[model samples]
Target chain A: MLQAAFVLVGTIFFAAVVLAVFRIVRGPSILDRMIATDMLVATLICALAAEMVQHEHTRTLPVLLVLAMTAFLATVGVARYVTQQDRPGGPQAEGGAAEGSAEGGAAGDDAAAHDTTSGRAAR
Target chain B: MSAAELLDAGSVLFLFAAALLSLAAGIGIVRFPDPLSRMHAATKPQILGLVCALVALGLQAENGATVAALVPILAFQMLTAPVSAHMVGRAGYRTRHLRRDLLLRDELADAIDKAHADAAHHDVEPDLPGLVTDEDTSTPRP
Candidate 1:
């Protein structure tokens, strides 16, 4: 039963990788491509975990560490790159705080929102 | 079948279920119409998938070392994924890469426009309080 389920899960995650690759290739916008790549990283982690079951091995755990860390670094790097052109008070001056706080559907001013978050992060 | 083998089979089923959750993330990334929604696609299910898979891996591990090492990886992933998603979403919003029509509500648009308007009028305060010159700085008359 373990072997059977391992094979089945492996096949499904493989299909997921193929679809993520398709999106990375055909994505219409830069952020779209980034999102696809992030999903690809996630699927890769899942695949690795499934194979850990297949081989009945646990020594490959370090690979999972490196993958998750690098995926995060890549995402933050590309995001900063995308917004590099914005001036401090440009039309999108409030983008960072606005979008982050907007995730909670808040109606607070951007500066105030950031002030609170940064304070909390500092603590 | 042995009891240990039965236990391994159950964990493998968990691995399969996590694979399915990750499949939903991939499909949502490809099919979601905009960056914010795509970000939504990329975060929640991805984190859940990783947790589920990691849990199954832990269950299958006979050695304590591997399970101990896996804990930090899980912690780091939980910490960073949301921060990365927030950064990406903000960048997309700043660059106007979003499809406003697809968004249910945009609280940022007007706030951004207002910020710009306030900036154009030179109403923003710059936070430099330490610098002083003889021309604009007056000394106390003792």
Candidate 2:
């Protein structure tokens, strides 16, 4: 029963990873990508813990500790950068306008892109 | 079933629950409408899923030391997940990544507008703490 459970859990984790990857690819904005990446890391951590449980060992526990501790730093850095970029007369002021226009267009296109992704997922 | 067998069964159950949470989080990230809404989805696996998996790990641990080691993983995740979520959500809000129409309440916008009006009022003529009237304090400058 335990063996069967492990296989079932593995299959679920695999699906989770695939879905997270899909979100990463389909995410419209940087924040959306960041959210997907965060979820992906959480899935990875859960997978590692499941492995430790299945193997009946502690060898990978440290890896779990390190991953949990540091995963948020990337999110913090990206958020700070986004906030800074939005500020007028900030270091990236010149390029911000161009990027903002492009992002605006992407936002306009978001509904269509969302439909395609959901359609593909459903199919 | 013996004690060891029972523990193993418990661990397996917990692991199954964690896996389901991860699956849910993935679906949420894909289906949520905006960054803030997606954030609500993404945080499930980070906190609840990790807790479930750690509980499973604790149940299956061979020794006390193994269980002890699992503590920090949970602690660190609990500590950091909120901080990151706040930062990301704030950035999303500031960047206009969230759908304003979908929001039920917008206290932040009200506060921001108030602050901007105050700043503009101050920019025109700086307020003196001593000279500031009660009426001026009660109603914000237009």
Candidate 3:
């Protein structure tokens, strides 16, 4: 019964890997790709953990730590890079565009984008 | 069922749930319409799935050493996942990948505007303590 459950979970993990890969490849924006990549590492960790349960494997635990750390650093590094982007006017222009959408009366969804850009203000 | 069988059953159940949650998170990343929403999918369920799977492994751990090790692993995951996701969210917002239409309440508009304005006169962090003010502060800005 335990083995069977492992197999079932393994199948699910396999499907998750395929789907996450698709998201990474098809993700439209750089940030979309980043989000997909984050999901992929998470799926990998889940799959590995499931395998550890099935095989009675207790030796390879450090690999999980290594994977988590790598994912964390990579994500933070990229995020810092994106936030401090060198483009002088890009963030401002986008901010303006978001505001314009708010005032121009596309109020429903546009407000979300506007408010998030300046989290402090909305508070 | 014997105690051993019951233990295995518990581990199996946890692992199964973990796998399904992981799959759902993956599907969320693929299907969510925007970056922020995709972030919602990416971090929360994924962390829960990781914890579930790790807990299952801990349940089956044969040695005290193994369970001991598992303790710190779970702790680290709980600590790190959100920080990474938050950093990503910040990057996405600054980069403007966030879809305005899907957003519910963006608290940062004024901060970004302040930062935008501040960029001209001096180098200031958009979220510098004084930069962001309450709603009343939104008015009277030159």
Top candidate (TM-score): 2
Point to the candidate with the largest DockQ: 3
Residue-wise lDDT of candidate 3 within B52-141, one digit each (tens)?
Answer: 888888888877888788777777777878888898877766545666666567778866676779885686544443221334222322
TM accuracy, model 3: 0.74
Cα lDDT, model 1, residue A94: 44
TM-score of each: 0.73, 0.78, 0.74
Where is model 1 chain A poorest over a 10-residue stretch in terms of lDDT?
A84-93
Q: What is residue B48's positional error in candidate 2, in angstroms?
A: 0.8
| Pairs of colliding residues, candidate 2 | none
Candidate 3, CAPRI quality class derived from DockQ: acceptable
Badly placed stretches (over 4 Å) of model 2 are A83-123, B124-142
Looking at model 1 chain B, which ten-residue stretch has the lowest summed lDDT?
B133-142
lDDT of 3 by residue, A14-75 (tens): 88888878878765556777778888888888788888877887766898877776777777
What is candidate 2's lDDT per residue for A43-81, written digit by digit as tens?
A: 999999999888888898889999999999999998877
Q: Fnat per model, in the order given?
A: 0.62, 0.70, 0.70
Q: List ranges where model 1 is wrong by over 4 Å.
A: A83-123, B113-122, B125-142
- Model 1 agreement with the true structure over A1-123: per-residue lDDT tens digits: 556767778888887888788878865455677888888888888788888877888767889998877788887887777642232222333444344444553322333334234322432
